[model samples]
Target chain A: AQTVTQSQPEMSVQEAETVTLSCTYDTSESDYYLFWYKQPPSRQMILVIRQEAYKQQNATENRFSVNFQKAAKSFSLKISDSQLGDAAMYFCAYRSGGSEKLVFGKGTKLTVNP
Target chain B: NAGVTQTPKFRVLKTGQSMTLLCAQDMNHEYMYWYRQDPGMGLRLIHYSVGEGTTAKGEVPDGYNVSRLKKQNFLLGLESAAPSQTSVYFCASRTSGGPSSYEQYFGPGTRLTVT
Candidate 1:
């Protein structure tokens, strides 16, 4: 079974500053996918970024990026130039290749202070 | 487009009561999933369907039933609600056929309180 872990339960960053959320996973499969999802108070789960295990290149989406260390089984999300809207609960998720189910971490509640 | 929509944004139920939560997607996705989000448990998949008239158990499927009779709709049912079942429910869908088909679009979750 695949499991995702987010060690930080809460994180805060000053506006315009950069923040990194840590995530680790346990999976035996060599081919899989990693994802970062954001959930605001609006209750919608939005995709932040995605990374495929075979690719060594990290995934970047606008201000969000991921540092995926396949050997360490670590996939961390970095938010650069953070804004107030970045304040939300961020979840790290994993899905094995060709599987429909996603395994998610507990979540990291991020606060962007102005 | 309303990518994915869940019915009854909020609901309060007593123990032993039964109800069905409906999820509809406008994107015509072939895969649909139901997940429950607890305070610290993140989102655990309860049930999922790969296509119409098909359903499968997920990580935590106990006490939950699901149906996908229609191509655009997925229904999750709780036979007997429990306090432990009180949590936010989210529905998601994604394209099934393609190389880059891992992205899932989520719905505005439905909060349920079982007292």
Candidate 2:
């Protein structure tokens, strides 16, 4: 079974500052996908960013980017110039390259202070 | 369009009570999934359907049964609920083919508490 680990249970960052959330996974598959999802108080899961394991280049989406170290089995999300609206529960997820099922991490609660 | 919707947003059940949660998607997606979310534990897949009338067991399927009689509807049943089963359940769907296959649209979720 594949397992995703998010060591940080909770994290906080000042407004306009940057914060990094760490994630690591255990998977034997050579090709896979990594994703970051955000869930606000409304409990709606929203996609943040995604990285393809086969791609050596990291994935970036506007202010959200991922540092994916495939060799280390680590995929971390970095929020640049964070805003209050960025506060939410962040989850790291993995999917087998062609498989549709996703394996998610425990989640990290992020608080953006004004 | 309501991408996906789950009925009985909140439910409370006794240990031996049986109930079913309904999930409907308007996107005509081929893949539908049921997941349970608990504190300190990430969302875990309970069951999923690849297409109409085809269901498959996921990571956690014990004590849970699902049926997909129609393409747009998926039902999850618990014949005998237990306190340990208390958690928030989410329903999601995605396109079968297309670049969007990996992107899952989720419902508002149903909070189920079994006493």
Candidate 3:
């Protein structure tokens, strides 16, 4: 079974600053997928970014980028130019190749203070 | 595109009560999943359907029953609701047959309380 771990339970960042949320996973499969999801107070789960294990270049979405170290089993998300809207419960998830299920981390609550 | 939608944004049930949570998607997806989210315990999959008329147990399926009679709709049933079941439930849908199939779109969750 694959497990994702987010060590930080909560995090805060000043407006316009940069923040990084750490994530690590345990998987024996060489091919898999990693994802970061955001859920606001509204309880809407939104996809932030995704990275494939085969890709050497980390995945990025505008201000959201990831530092994926496959050998270390680490995939961290970096939010540059953080804004108030970035405040949410960020969850790191893992899905093995050809599987439909997702294993998730406990998530880190992010607060962007102005 | 409405993506995915779960009926009854909020629900309350007493012990031993039975209720069904409905999940519908308009993306013509081939897969649908049910998950529960509890504080400090991320989301855990309860059940999922690969396609119409096909369903499988996920990580946690002991207290739940799911049916996917229709390709676009999936239903989860709790025969005897318990206080331990008080949490938010989420529905997700995704297409199969491509590299991007791993992308799953989630619906606005349903908050259920068993008193």
Q: What is the interface RMSD of candidate 2, in Å?
A: 0.9
Which stretches of model 2 miss by more than 4 angstroms? Answer: none
Candidate 2 residue A74 Cα shift, in angstroms, is 0.9
Off by over 4 Å in 1: none
* Tens-place lDDT digits, model 1, residues A1-114: 788999999999999999999999999999899999999989799989999999999999999999999999999999999999999999999999877789999999999999
RMSD of each predicted structure: 1.0, 1.0, 0.9
Q: What is the per-residue lDDT of model 1 for residues B1-115, given as tens digits with 9 covering 90 to 100? A: 8789999999999999999999999998999999999987789999999999999999899999999999999999999999999999999999977864788999999999999
Write one digit per residue (lDDT tens) for candidate 2, span A42-105: 9988989988888999989999999999989999999999999999999999999766578999
State what share of the real interface contacts each candidate retains. 0.86, 0.66, 0.77
Local accuracy by lDDT, each model: 0.94, 0.94, 0.95
Which residue window of length 10 is worst by lDDT in model 2 chain A? A93-102
What would the TM-scores of all predictions be?
A: 0.98, 0.97, 0.98
Compared with the true structure, what per-residue lDDT tens digits does model 3 show for residues B1-115? Answer: 7889999999999999999999999999999999999988899999999999999999989889999999999999999999999999999999986876878899999999999
Worst 10-residue lDDT window for candidate 3 chain A reads A94-103
Name the top lDDT candidate.
3
Inter-residue clash pairs, candidate 1: none
Q: What tens digits encode model 2's per-residue C-alpha lDDT throughout B1-115?
A: 9899999999999899999999999999999999999988788999999999999998899999999999999999999999989999999999988877778899999999999
Q: Judged by DockQ cut-offs, is candidate 2 incorrect, acceptable, medium or high? A: medium
Candidate 3's C-alpha runs over 4 A off are none
